[model samples]
Target chain A: MKTPGEQKDRTWILAAPGVGYLTVLYALPLGLLLLASFRLPEAFSISAYVDFFGDPFNWYIIWNTLRSALLTTAFCLLIGYPAAFALAWSKGWLQALFLVSLILPLSVGIVVKAFAWTIVLRSDGVLNQALMALGFTDEPVRLIFTETGLIFGAVNVFVPFMIMPVYSVIRLLDPRLAEAARTLGAGPLYVFWKIILPLTVPGIIAGIAFVFSLALAMYVIPTLLVGERFMTLSQQIARSYLYLRNETLGSTVAVVLLVFSLIVIVASQWLAGKVRANT
Target chain B: MTVLERLARLAVWTIGLAVCVYLMVPLFVTVAVSFSASPVFDLPPPSWSLRWYEALGSKRGFLPSLSLSVQIALISTGISLVLGTLTAIAVVKGRFPGRTAISTFVVSPLMMPGLVIGIALLQFLREIGYRDAYTGLILGHVIVTLPFIMRTVQASLSLFDFTLIDAARTLGLSYPKAVVKVLVPVLSPAYLSSGLFAFLASMDNYPISIFLTDARNKTLPIQVLEYLEVRPDPTIAAISSLLILLTIIVLVISDRLVGLRRMTDF
Candidate 1:
C-alpha cells in the first residue's frame, strides 16, 4: 500500500482534468467577463453602470424581468404545493404517468416549448377554440404577446422545479408526526400548519430560488412567446452582443444578471440553512 | 375521517390532477396538432392525418443541424462521463480540504443563467481565437453536461460499498481490475441515467450554442427556433413531437434502469 501522504496527495489528481477544464474554460471566462464590465483602458469605471441605469428603458427591462419571474414563482408555488402531495401519494400507473409527464416536458427543448406556447396562444389557437366552445368567450381572445400569456408559459415550464423539491421534502417527512398530532386531537389544518409547513420551508425556499432565478434569466420562452412586445434583460444582452456589438453594454448587463442570480442562490441557501437549524 | 380532512384531500387531488393536465397541455397540443389536417395549430384536428410527419421525412433544411446536434450531444456526453466519473471518485474517496466547495463550484454552472454563461464564453472564445464553432460548442456542452453526471455518480458512489473492491482484490484481482469488476457494474445505472440526461441537455441547449454557432454550423434548436419565427407551421410540431418521442424513450429506458423516483432523487 502507498503511504498515507502519497495516497492523499494523489487523490486530487482524479479531479484535476474536470477542475482544470472548468477553471480554464468556464471560471476564467466568467472572471474575464466580469472584468470586462469594469474595463476602461487600465482603469475600472462605473460609467457603464451609470450609462445603463441612467436610461429609463433599462429600469423597465429590470422591472419586466423581475415581475415576470415573481409572478411565475408565485403561480408555481400555489400550483406545485398541492401537486407535490398528489405526486408523492399517487400509486401504480398514475405515478409513472405523472412522472413521465413532468420529465417529457422538461426533456423537450425550451425553444420547442416556447414555440408550442406560441401556437397555443395564437388568436385562432386551441386555447381560444376551447374557450369559445365552452361559451366562456364569444370571440377569440388576444392571449399571445401578453404578460399573462408569458407567465402562463413560464409557470408551466417552471412548476416542476417547485414540485420536485417540495415532493422530496414531503417524502423525507415523518408521517407519524402528523398522525400523532391527530391522535392528540389536533385538527388536520392545525397539524399541517404547525408541523408540515415548517419542515418544508427549506424545500419551498429552494424551489423559489430555482424557479425565480431561472425564470428571471429565461430568454427563449420570453423571446418566442411574447417577442419584441416585451423587453427583458436576456433579450437586451443578446441585442447588445449580437446586434449592437457593444461589449461594454453586454458585459455590464450580464454582470447585473449574474448578481441577481447570485443573490437569489446565496440568500436561498442561507434561508434554508436557518430554517433547517431552527427546525 | 372529518369533513374538513376529506374536503382538503379532495381539494389536493383536484388541484394536483388539474396541474398535471396543465403541464401536459402544450405537449399534448403539440402532438395533437402534428397529426392534424389543419395547416395551423388547431385542436381535435379538422381531420386526422400524418401530413406533418411525412413533411419531416422530406425536410432537408433541418438535416445538417440535426446531425450536428446529435454529434455534439454524443461527444460532449462522452467527455462528461469520463471527467465527471473522475471528479466524483475524487470527491467521494479522496480526503480533501475543499470537497464541498469543489462540488458546489462544479454544479454551479447548472444553476447559473445560461445566457450569462453564453456571453462570457463568447467573449472568452473571441479572446482565445477559438477558430471553429464545433470545438467551441463541445467545450460549452461539456460544461453544461458535467454537473448532471457528477451529481448522480457522487450520489450513487456514496451509497456504494468500497469493501467490494477489497473483496475482489483478495480474490486475486488487481486494484484497477477489482474496481472494474466491482464498481463499474454497480454504478452503471447512475452512469446511464446521468449520461442520458447530459446528452439531452446538450441536444436541447440553446443559449450557449447560440453564441457558438456560425451560419454553417447551427444546432437543431437554433434552426428550429428560426423556423418557428419565419414559418409558423405544423412542420415545427412534427419536429417537436419527434424530440418529445425521444424524451419518452429516454424516460422509459431510465424508468426500467432506475425508477424515475430514484433518478429524480439524484
Candidate 2:
C-alpha cells in the first residue's frame, strides 16, 4: 500500500478537475450574485440593499416567507417523526410498501406535484367534493389561493425530506437500547423521550435545516398555488428578474434568501456538533 | 401488548398509512383526471378515454422541450457521473489537508437553494456575455446533480475492497486496468442508482432551469407550467402521468439493481 503522505500528495490530481470546475461555476456565480446586489444600474452602491430594507412590504414578505417555511418544517417533523420511527421499526413487505409509497412521490417532479395539488385543492375540486358529500361543508371551502393550502402542499412535498434523514439515523440505532430501557421499567413514551429522542436529534436538526431551506426557496409550489396574492421571497426574486426586469432587486432578494439558507446550514452544523459532544 | 401499547401501535400505523395515502393521492388524482372524458379535470373519470394522452402529441413546444430536457439530463448526468466518481475516490481514499473542506464544498450546492444558484448563474452568465441557453442549462444541472453522485459513490467506495485492485495488479494487470476490472464492477450498483436518481433530479429541475432557459429552450417542467397557465386541462395531467410512470420505472429498476434502502439511507 502507498504511504499516507504519497496518497495525500496524489489527491490533488484526482480532486483538481472537479474542484476547479466547481470553483469556476459555483463559487464564481455566487460571487457574481454578491456583486450584482451591490452594483446598481448607475454605479456600485448599496442603494438596492437600502431600497430593499426601506420597503416594509419587502420585510413583511421576508418574514412571511420564513414563517411559512417554519410552519412547513414543523408540520413535516410532526408527521414525519412517527412515520420515520415506524419505518425504522418495521420489517419486510410493510417497510417496502412504505418505502415505495414515499420514494415514488419524491422521484416525481415538484412541478407535477404542485399541479396535482392544484387539481385537488381547487374550489370545485376533489377535496371540496368529498367534504360536501361527507356533510362537512355546504359549499366548496376556500382552500386554493390560501396560506393553509400552501402549507398543506409544502408539507406533502417536503415531509419526505424529514423522514429520510430521521429514518436513516433511527434505522442505525441498536434495538437493545430501547429494549434495555423497557426492561428498566420505562414505558414506551418514556423510553422514546429519554433514549430515542436524544439519539435522533442530529437527524431532526438536519431535517429541519433541509426542509426549512427548501421551503424557503420553493418557487414552484407557491407560484402554482397562491400566485401574486401571497408573494414569497422566492416568488419576489423571480418576479423582479423575469417580470420587473430589475436585476438588482432580484439579486438583493436572492441574497436575503441565500443568507437565510446559509444560517440554517450553519445552525444545523452547530447543533450536530453539540449533539456529538454530548454523546 | 398492554392496551396502551396496542393503542400506540395502532396510532402509529394509522398515521404511517395516512401519510402514505396523503402522498399518493395527488398523483392518483392527476392520473385519474387525465382519463376523464370531460374537458375539465375530474376525479373518477366520467368515462375512460385516451383523448388527453392523444392531445399530448399535438401540443406545440411539448416534444421539443421534452427532448431538450432529456438531452440536458443525459449530458449533465454523464458529466457528473465521471467527475463525481473521481471526486468521491479522492474524498474517500485521499488523506489530505482540507479534504473535509473540499468534500463539504463539493456537496454545498445541494444545501444551497436552486433559485439562488439559478439567479446567480443568470447574473454570472450575463456578466461573462455567455448567453447560450443550452450551455448555461447543462452547467446549472451539473451543479444540481453532482452531490447525489458524489455521495452515493463515496458511500459505495467505503464498502469496497481495495485489496481486489492489489490482487489484480499482482496478476499482471496494470493499475488502471485493475481498477476498471475490479472496482468498476463492485461499484456498478452505486453508478446505476445515482445515475438514475441524478437523471430524474435533472429532468424534474425547474427553479434552476427557469433562469437559464431562453424563449425557445424551455425545459419540460417550465414548458408544462407555461402550458398550464394558458390551458388548464387534462393535457398537463397526461404529461404528469407519463412522468410519474417514468419515475416508477426508475424506482423499480433501482430497487431491483440495488435495494432502495441503499439509495435512500442518506
lDDT of 2 by residue, A149-256 (tens): 999999999898899889888887998998988888999879878998998998898888889988998899999888898989999988998899987788899999
* Per-residue lDDT of model 2, residues B4-106, tens digit only: 8888788878888889899898878888888889977766677889998998889888889989999999999999988998988888877777877777788
lDDT of each residue in B5-99, candidate 1, tens digit only: 89989988998899888888888888898899999666678898898888886876687888999999999999999999899888988886788
lDDT of 1 by residue, A138-256 (tens): 98899999998999899998898899889888988999999999999999889989999988887899789889988988999989888886999999988888889988899999999
State the DockQ, from 0 to 1, for candidate 1: 0.70
Residue A112 lDDT in candidate 1: 81
Alpha carbon deviation, residue B74, candidate 1 (Å) = 1.7
Q: In candidate 2, which residue pairs clash?
A: none
Q: What is candidate 1's CAPRI-style docking category based on DockQ?
A: medium
What are the Cα lDDT values of the candidates?
0.87, 0.86
- Give me the candidate number with maximum DockQ: 1
lDDT of 2: 0.86
